[model samples]
Target: MRCQTCGDATSPEHHECQRCYTPLGQPAVTPGLPTYRVRGIGLAANVAVGATAVLYLVVALYPLIGMVMARRAMANDDPDLLVSALIISAVVALIMTVAQLTAAVLVIIWTWRARKNTDAFPGAEPAFGPGWAIAGWLVPFANFVVPARVVAGVARDSLWRRATPPLVAVWWCSWLVFSIGERLATRADDRAYEKLAETPFDDAGYQAYVDHYQDALLRNTVPALGCVIAAVTLILLIQRISAAQEARIAHATPQWPTAPIWPAQVWPAAQPASGVQSAPGAQSASGVPGVQPAAAAQPLSEVPGAAPAS
Candidate 1:
């Protein structure tokens, strides 16, 4: 068999890889998971990713509308009309933002599940422990680095530790850069809106707000584009990883016809002791094997070396 860690060819009879000493035949935490069920997670994640990608595409273009509106407001085309446009834009942005966040959450959940499923096999040794997949994205400063590392590790392990997925770096870089841009732009946007609130309809006072709004809209495009690319790349990575795991599990195991074997026993039926005298020529009434009648099964009553009746 090929060693998972060291890529060494070794005799199949050995329990550990000769080159790297990695243990073989280790039991899975979730044994007997069906392929279709495991694949279902990937399918669900892909759906979320596809939805996110489409929404991100909308997000990318949605900014253009905002930029145009801001420009119109700056030109003082119509104060009431621009105010109404801003309200409408705000509502649409809120709904889409909620949707995008939901999709992102779904992606994380499914990806984490997929990584866990890979652990059902020995060859797929993900670098990060499973919790980081979720927590990596939640922790404040650590999130920026941890999530990317976790993804890279899972991507490599999913491929049988053979090669890293090509787009993983791209996905991580774009995601981080876009996130930074989004945060900065949001702060600027808030300040811009605060200024606009100070003078609801004054054209001369609106220029700063209009400029900042335009900047925010344009800035959002960075993350939106990143979201689109990351979603697509991630969908592919998930599909690849899940497929590899399915193949590995099928090849590494053949368990459908097997039965569970208990590790030890207790509460066994009582048995007759050796050398107790039984009525001459009598046998046990029950059909149990190797158990003589009580009379011939007394415990330690006979001499240790004494001959017994034939």
Candidate 2:
């Protein structure tokens, strides 16, 4: 028989799956609860996240490109090309932001559905309810840890009695690192740009502005790299959880027998052999020979010591 949780083949004699340790023939916690399928949404979230990561890499390289542009503008005495480059960078940044938002929405939806599915699995015990899947990401200071817990809970419950994938920790850590680094980088860039705008148009001022911009770009590379690692790990984690849930659903489904194991048969009551017959004097009113019915009792007055009837 195949283990429901992990889809591994196991001996029918065993009480649990050797690969994942899930109990054999375990019944669902709620017998008739519905389960939501997350495989399709997971795939879409993976694609969106992959695109966001690629965009982050491109954005990280923007600083180096900006520095080259600055140098070329100074040499050729032309600012128009530099302005165009800045506009292109802004456009790319906008696109990256949209991709990030799309990815976030898709992932949250998938998480919510996955959490709901745990009710149909026997050993699943989610730490939070389905609502937390979305609310965890919205809470201010708690967002960092709550969202991680929500995902971790889903993974644990989905693969009940099995070790959760390590990718969950890796992805959460990298995501947190990227979030913090990106914020810091954005603040630094804003300060540098404000100072650059205030500086008088002179040789020293231009050089200072270029240096500041290049430094900001270099700092962004850290978050960009983190984003890539988080995205890849998240994709793998989603695949693992989705497959486990699918296997569990298949196992929990009831399989009806196509035919009865022993079909019932009926026979007519037994009869005497072909030539048999009852003798002429054997039959009587009671259907037996040499037997007499009991006589009715005599009246009570007939007894010597009996009192007369009232």
Winner by lDDT: 2
**Predictions in order: lDDT:** 0.64, 0.76
TM-score per candidate, in order? Answer: 0.64, 0.74
Q: lDDT per residue, candidate 2, 1-310, as tens digits? A: 6765566787878887676556686653347798887889999999999999999888888888888777766666566656766788899989999999999999999989888888666656678888998999998988989888888877887765455557789999999989999989888887777776442355565566578767977889889888988999999888888988877777667888798676444322343343333333443334445322222123446645767767
Give the per-residue lDDT digits (tens) of candidate 1, residues 1-310: 5654445776768876654344663432235653333467677778867776676556546646665665676676455645666677677667667766876787677667766665655545677877888988898898988877777776776564455666888887777766777677668767767766544466655565566556766777777777777777777877877776666555546457668785552322554554454443444545334445454464443546556656
Model 2, residue 94: C-alpha shift (Å)? 0.5
**Model 1 ranges off by over 4 Å:** 1-36, 67-77, 197-213, 250-310
On a 0 to 100 scale, what is the lDDT of residue 53 in model 1?
66
Candidate 2 regions with alpha-carbon error over 4 angstroms: 1-25, 28-30, 160-164, 198-200, 254-310
